[model samples]
Each structure stands twice: as structure tokens, then as C-alpha cells.
Target: MLKESTELSMILVQNRQQQLNGNKRLFAWALVLLLFLGACSPKTRVLKSPDHRGGNVGGTIPKEEKPEGVDKEKTVEDARRAEAARNSVALILPFQLDKISPRTLLKEDVNRSAIALDFYQGFQLGLDELAQEGRSFSLNVVDSRDSEVRNQYVAKSEEISNAALIVGPVFPKEITSFGTHLSNKNVLQVNPLAATRAREFNLPNLVSLTPSIDVHTKAMAERVARDYKTGDVVIIYNTSDNDGRQFLNGFLSELRKVNSSAQVRSVSSVPQLNEEISLTGTNLIVAGTTDRFQLRSFVSNLEAKSSQEYYVFRVYGHPLWERIDFSIYERFGDFRPIITAESHLKTWTREAKEFKENYYSLYGVSPSDHSYKGYDAARYFGNLLAKYGDNYPEHITKEKFEGLFSAYMFDYNESWGFVNKAVSFKSYQGSSFQLN
Candidate 1:
């Protein structure tokens, strides 16, 4: 069995170094190539399709057209008919293929190009599974480098123009550039990456798989409203940061809708926190700032209060609390620390275990969060396209899909298109993370 949090925690720890060095993109590339190379005996090998028909092997797939009025057997004819009507899913990602050479693969290139390969591999697995269910997919894979010219070229292609669903173009700017061309069309664009919701690609058909900061806070507020009825909630915010203020505003809006009597407090020190915590029923403390110093202070003070507290104090903190020394926060007794996550993998599940086994067999290593994300994205969109045909968006919310590492429960926004409202609530229990 996969060690649930340890593996994920280690990956996060390793990712931080890459993130700080401005090389996290490269880190993902490195991990992907490491897995890919492990599958092969020799350094250089051409990746090919099982069937005779050609596919994009770290390159573009040439567009194939069906012959007009072609004669065929009944089975072949039915297959052809299904193929012609299959949903076109255009996957636009930054492969950076020109930087990579199978003959002379460098350590740095692997680091830089791993994300595209990893996502592609997992997506392929998902598509393969869908094929078993008689689902036809017209996949148009394009490499959109971090250049406007590349994005522009791909956006103008017939494959993309005629596509029913667009999977990526990972970065926010590229999404905007590609979406700008297809704004008038009813193409359902999926932003599989990026946490920030870009203003440029706020079209009705664009769906963001990664929920925004505001979305995270809103979900937390809703959960608090529904669950903590006995508590008198207090939102402690910092006055300096505009983003923090924005989060505070959203939290207050949601809090008012449910618990209209909840109080908002702007406190910076231990003395002020003590003053706020003196009188309460069951106190629901919300740390509204993302500042590390502020977080540390609040956490330390809260820990100090555990000895003398009469009423129950359950903490609901910002997601940035993950970056802090959790060893200290974990020391606090009965502190139900709640935070929102974009995606949370339940590795204990049979589906997850199966996916891990398949992945390890193929790559010689356990799968990471990115690998699971790719699988989920492909499974979700491919299944939807097969079931609903070209009009899949019309029936998006009809079914709810629980994937290996993610959940799909989308709510359509007129300005920002389809935003995934699903977020995982994790509580720090027994010095470990557990889904609540």
C-alpha cells in the first residue's frame, strides 16, 4: 500500500526547492522524464502507436480526413460513423520538444519538460481506458510554448478551431491568447492548471479545474456556516495586504449569509487575540491573513491559550498555513485546524491503488499529484464527451465524478465560465492530514 501522506509530503518538500529557484516547471519535467526513461531499456527509442495509424510522438499529430463515400463492412462502417462523430479534444501544452533530444537528453531538459510528458502519459492512460468502453476520441495534441506566436499559430489551426473541447495551454496568458481567437465559438475550454483565475479568459465556455483563492475561502466559509453552529466565529485580518482584505471581504459576505451575528476582528498581537477570545461560546477562529509572521504569532498565541481556555476554540486558517512549521501547530490540543485544498488524493481507495500499480509498472516509480491530475482530467472530459457528444456542457452538472486525486462538481459563472466548486477540507489530526 502507498504511504498516504509521506510520499505526497516528500514531493511537496522537494517541489519547494524548485519553486524557490524559479525551476518548479523544470522539476515537473525532470520527474516526468525520469519516469519515461525508466520505462525504456535504451536511451533513444521512438514512441509509437499500437495501431499502424500514426500519432504525435513528442510532436504534432497530422490531421487525417475520412474518405468521402467509402465502402466498408457493417462493423467497419459503424466504427467509421462513430469515429467521424467523435468529440474533438485539443490538448495544447508546452512540450518544449525542440529543447529535448532522445539521443542526447540532458538533465536540465528533463526538468524543464517533465510536466507536458507526465500529463500526456496519464491522459493517454485515461483515453486508453475510455476506448475499452467504446468511446471514440479525436485527439489534437499541440505544443504551445511560452510564446504568443506559438499560441497564435495553434489557435488558428483547423484542429483547434473545430475542436469541441480544449484541455490546456497550461499558463494563464496562453489560455487568454488561445481563448481570444475562439471567444465567439462555443468551445468548452478547460484550464487544467493555474490557481489564479485570469481576467482575460473569463468567457462562458472556459472552465477552470483549479479553484481560485476566493473560491477556497468561500468554500471554507460555507463549511463553517453549516457545521459550527455552537461557535461564535471571529475573522482576524491584516490591514496591510490588499489580497488579504479581498479574502476578508469574501469571508465576511459568506459569514453574514449564514451566521449574521459572527464578529470580525482586526488584531495583530497576542494581547489583542486574548481580548477577543475572553468571551465566547465555542469560538471559531479564522486567521484571514497569509503573512507568515502573522500566522506564526496567531498559532503560537493560540497554543498558549489551550492551558487556560474554558470554551472550545476550533481554528479555520488560510491555506498558506501549510508552509509553516506544522510541528508547532500540531502540538495544540483539540485544535481542529481546517484548510482548503484544490485536489486531495485518497490513496487508500481501490481505484487509486490500481492507478498506482499501473503507473509503477510503467514508470518504475510511484505516481505523483501531477500524474493523478492528468488521469482525472482525461477521464472526466473523455467520459463526458463520449456520453454527451458535442453538447457536453449542457449536461455537465448532471453527473458527479470522484476521481483518483480530484473531484468534479462545477458551478457555472457568467463572467468566469465553469469554476469547480469542489475543495477538500483537511484537518490536522494526530499530527497528520486527514480529510474531514
Candidate 2:
């Protein structure tokens, strides 16, 4: 009887094991179905049809035969009208939905998905606003999957090929790869997030929304040059990596351009930096490092040294410093640190307040920086597309926009495409950074 009981227990354990395996398989299938549905849902709004043309729905005008010797200007105008009638925009982002798993999922995966979702939602809201304003658009959202192979495939797809405006494929590598594939196309591809220099990509049809590090350096340098006095000392503390050194070089170049006679000292060590700080005239110190740890140590040391000697100084920091939390350093405020900011959202403004309320009501959460970025890109580019049609690229530099997060003033480069040169300076004061 005891032997029989043991055999019965083993059988029951085997049955339970099989049941668990079956449940896992069910869960995996369910997750995949949910992801597929999510992709086709209103959030993505992917237009589908049984027709061979893939249901373009953008109201593209059919080409009509024209007799020889038709006026060229009239032909062009007709083409523009046709283009205006066809308003299709494609947004390609790294959703990486294919990597989702029931097991072995990581936090980074969730974060990436969240970023994509937030940006998509914000972009949709912007387009929704335009729709209400009578600007019709057929937006096709594509997932790049953050893979080069996937990006290349998407870039060559019919939807992307026909888009009036294409925004994203987010990261620098993906942008370059995708843009390279579409080099022959006349479509303007906006680099939505990467702050990498425009010249690096050399894509003539690219529009970079994020201000490059060089732009930040130049802005800070100009500000420093403007504030320079005869008695004031200019110093650079540069214990940075190659990327950071590029910023330092750019800053120095711009500073020299404005004030060729300006005497600036460069120091690497803490003791050397301390020796240059003066108690008399204002000491303008540039913290030329992108390293957050180094920045914290440097700021802490400066604060300690300043307190000990009552040094009167102004600290000009790298753009990356904007992301570092200096609130922990009690004396960081005393230095009056200034950093170049690309996005300055005035939350107190009526427009900003309304946007926040509307966004919260729609998404049940506050908008992230990416959300603001996506909204501005959609609104700015959508308006341009609606206004100028196929020739919107010609008018890109002519238009200036002030959105919730950023002010856009584009300068066209023959080699590097369009660069957003608008940058704002923020000074740390009264426990918070404010526009200066």
C-alpha cells in the first residue's frame, strides 16, 4: 500500500509539471496577441486595407496627362496642390516590441517601451490638434525595433517611401542607417532625439531637432565672452574624455572668435584650478567635462574652496551638467552655475498649464521630456507640411516656432542638412535653475 501511495504522488507531480508548462505556453501566446493588437490599436493607428495600394488614405491625387508646352510654373503649382492634398507622415521609433518575453524581461526593456509609447501619444495629440484645425493627415507609425536590420527594412518599406515627413528611428546609429537607405528620396527625415553633431551623419535631407553639443558650447562661450571684463579671470577645468574635450575645443574657439584678446587659463588638477580663483574680480570658470561623477567632485571641491576663501566666481558648466543633481551640494548655488539648455518649458504659462491638464486627462500621467519633444516636432512639422506641401523643405529655415519645450530656429547646411541653433541659458538661483 505504501509503494502504491509513492507511485500515486509521483504521477500527481508529473501532471502538475505538465500543467505549469501548458500555462506558460498559454501566457506567451496571449502576450504576443496583446502586443499585435496593441500595435494595430488607436494608439498606433496603423491604416490597413485589402487593396494592393495598402490603403494610403492620404488622398493622393492621381497624375493627369498634360499636353506639351504646358506652362512650367502652372505645372509646378499643380504638383504642389497635389502634394498638399496628400498629407501622409511616418513616425519610426524604437519600440523593440519583438523582444518582449514572459520571462527574462528587464527594466530597460520596459523603459524603452515607455519612451516609445509616451512619444507616440504626444505626437498623436499634436496631430489631433492639427486635425481639429482642419489639417488632415494620414500618420503611419512604424516600430524600428532598435535593430539596424529592422531599421533598414522599415526605411525601404512603401509607407516610409511615400511619407511627406518622416520623424525618427531615434538613436544616432539607427538614424544614420535609416537615412542612408533613403538618401535618394527627397523626404525630410527629422532626427528627433540624438544630440550628436549634424556633420557626423552628413545626410542632406536630415533635420536635427536637438541642439548639438557644439551648439551648447558656442552659446556658453558667447555668453562668457559677452560677460567678460578686463579684471575678470577666465579659467577652464578640463579633465574630460574625448567627447568632452571636443566641447572644450568648440567653446574655446567660439570664445576666441568673440574676444581674441581674452586671456583664458586651462587647468586639469584640483590644486591648479584652486590657484586661479580670485577673491577680487569675478572668476569665470568653465567646467568642461561630460562626466557626472567628475562634475560632482569638481563642484564639491569648488564649493569647499570658495567657502574657505570667500571666492567670488561664476561656474559655466557643460550641457550634461543640466542632468546632474546639484541640490545635494549645499554650496553649489553659491557658485551661480550656468548651463546651456535645449528645452525650457515654462510650466506656469497658460498654454503650458492647459497642455498639462489635457495630457493628464488623455494619458492619465504627466508628459515626459520625450512627450514634449514629440509634440513640438509634430506640431511644427505638421504645420509646415500643411502650409507648404511638398516644398516644405524650402520654407523650413523661414519658419520659427516656440513650443512648450523648445524654440526652433533652423539653419540649413548643404553638407549636414538643417540644424536647430536655438539654445537657452539657465542659471542656478534660489535652489532652482531658471532661464537667464
Candidate 3:
């Protein structure tokens, strides 16, 4: 269904444009009437919530700037979008830069300091680019570790209320308090790491960079339908692990959204999948576990059976794909694994690659998806702060920005909560991952 959905988008957009033109003459007449009324009116007409765009209208360009090789007219249009893009990002306040004990996660390995610096390092890279482009940055590194005073919550609220974009305290409790508080402030509070199921909100300003359960699950299911449209889908999980449960929930959610009415199967242990696999004519499996031993065992069994059921056999999972030794991919031999990570290896920023290679060279082991995730989150939003700063709402709010970590599309739903604005799919097709 999504395959078709993606193809139909251009048709839909053109139909919308045709509808917009239908009322152009009427809009012109209305504008003339408005001008006539303005001449006779005692005060300028005022109505709240006027539509900002659309309709036949004329005015001076919204912004003006020099362009690379464009004439004056095109430069004006480019300037408007550039200004709008610059304004869309929000400014997240860090914990007080002067206050709080700077307690960093000490590196156990030799390259701890270098690896740890990555988050701030990537963020500064964005900041440096914006400054070179002649943009001003108004960033405040608040001491997030500050102890809260009860009455002072209001004062703290006032201090941050003006900030259109807020990054995070990166702790569950801090996220809860600030999330609840800022949900009302029209400011976005993005939590890079501390994604726990504390509560849900309808805040226009609040968006989670990570998919909680629903988005991940649904996407996994959609990919399943596409990859194995005729197959019986099985969800295998370890009952003990929380990640297993979270991923299983997501897999089932995705299955429900697919266009075809496919058979869905489930089981608790590896032994159960072995038996269930025999019964399901086609098996598309999701191994949802972060534990390496469990995942390895699961992979070994599934790979042994791949030749028997692979016409529609596919295996999928979460960011846990990062934790397991990737060299094991060749070990799996015939059976390929599909990991649902944020993005592909090549999708990393230039600094991201440098950090990864350098991190591996120093630490031996590579960084986990979560590590890059944190690096990307900090880098992305930190750059947002460094660029738009205070003027975030005017530009960032209206446009969807796709970046290294996640796609920052401000979409929300009343029932399911904020769908993770961005997610990329990659599959380990028995060897290296192939991005879809």
C-alpha cells in the first residue's frame, strides 16, 4: 500500500494546486472589496487566525539576500525560504553553564574523552557553519543539574518560556517535569536519550525524536508486508526483556496496518519459533531482543532454517542490531537480518564517520546506535539552537527538516500521540545492510 501511496503523492499535489486556482478570480474581487472597505473604515479590520499563505495576493518579498549565481528576483525567493528555514529551529536551553558540577560519563576505555566530546563536537560543527553564513546564535547552556525550588518553578518557567525550542535534560524525571511544563509553553522539548513512557501530551510544541513503540512497530510491519506480502508473519520475543516486549508490540502494530490480510503468528521462546515456523507456510520473523546471547542463538537457529522457508522469510528487529557483533553477519551465512536502526552507516555526518572510525581505532569496539543516536540528537538540535536560536518558531515550525539523526517533521495526532517525525529503514540482506 505504501508503495502505491508514495507514487500517488504527485497526483494529489497537482489536484491541490488546481483547486487553489479555482478561486483566484473570487480572491481578486475580495481583495478589491477589502481595499474599498479599508478606505471607509474607522480602524483597520482585524480578525484572529488569518490564513498566512494561499490566495491571489501581492506584496514585497518577505526576505532579501545574495545568492550563488541567481538574478535579483530568484535571490529574493531563496532569501525568504532561507530566512524561514533559519527561523523554524527552536533554542533548547542547556543546564546553567556556570552552575552545577560537570559530571561526565567517565570513559572506561582509553579514548573516553575523545568519544565523549563527539556530542558537543558535532553540535559545534553546525554552529560554526551558521556563523560562517553570517547567522547569529543565542545559545544558553543552563545547568540542567540544578536542584528545583518549588516556588521557583514559575521563575524557571519564565526563563525558558521565551525559548521557542528546548533540547533536554536527558533524564526521565527531568523530561517528565519539563515535558509537562513546556507542553503548554509552545516550545519543543526534544529528549535525545531519556525516552521512557512517562506520559503522553497533545502539546503542539512537543515532538519526540525517537519512536516510542507505535511508530517503530508500524514501520516494521509495513516493511514486512512489502518484503513478504504473501508470507505468514511471526513475532518472536524473549518474555523477560523489556526491549523484546517493546519491539514485539511495534511488530504487531505494523502488521495491522498492512494492505493484505496476512496470517500473524507469535511465540515466547526460540523453541516455540522452531515449531511455529513449520506450521506457517511462509515465515517473516522479527527477533526483538537487545541481549546478544539471545539474539545470537535466535539468529543461529533461523539461519539454519532459512533454506527451508525463505521464499517469504525475512527477520527484522530494533536498534539492538547495533549491540550484536556485526561480524556475525557472515556467520549467519544464508539467513539475512533486517535491523530497524535510525539510519544507514553511510547516512552518518562526515564528522559522524570520523568519530566512528576514530572511536573504533581507539576503543576497538564500534559505537552503538544509541551512541550515534545521542551524538546525532545533540548535533542536530544543538545546531538548531546555534542557528535559529530565538527566532525558531517563525521558520522551523512551518517546514519539515530532515537531518542525520531524525527527520524533524512537526506532525502530531490526538489519539496515538506524536508519531516520531522521522525513521529510516535498513536491512541486512544476509550480509551488509541495504537501505530502503
lDDT of 1 at 107: 65
Error of 1 at 404 (Å): 1.4
Report the C-alpha lDDT of model 1 over 1-436, residue by residue, as the tens digit.
Answer: 0111122224434544433333444444454454433432112111111332323234433445433323233355466445534566777777665556556656667656567666765776676567555556666666675567777777777767767788888888888877777644578888887776634577677888887788888888887776655446564644455555655567867767887765556565568768777445667777666776766777777777776666567877666655555666655537778878766788788888899887655544456677788889989988888777877888776667788888888887777788887788888777655677
What digit string (tens of lDDT, one per residue) describes model 2 on residues 320-353? 6766667888888888889889987888899898
TM-scores for the candidates: 0.79, 0.79, 0.60
How high is the CA lDDT of each candidate model?
0.66, 0.75, 0.48
**Model 2 pairs whose backbones collide:** none
lDDT string, candidate 3, 172-241, tens digits: 5555555555535555666554445324544445556665555566667787777664545554554567
Model 2 error, position 278 (Å): 3.2
> What TM-score does model 2 achieve against the real structure?
0.79
User: In the order shown, what is each candidate's alpha-carbon RMSD?
Assistant: 9.3, 13.1, 18.5
Which regions of candidate 3 fall more than 4 Å away from where they truly are? 1-118, 146-161, 181-184, 197-204, 231-238, 278-282, 306-312, 326-333, 344-398, 414-419, 429-436
**Lowest summed-lDDT stretch of 10 residues in model 1?**
40-49
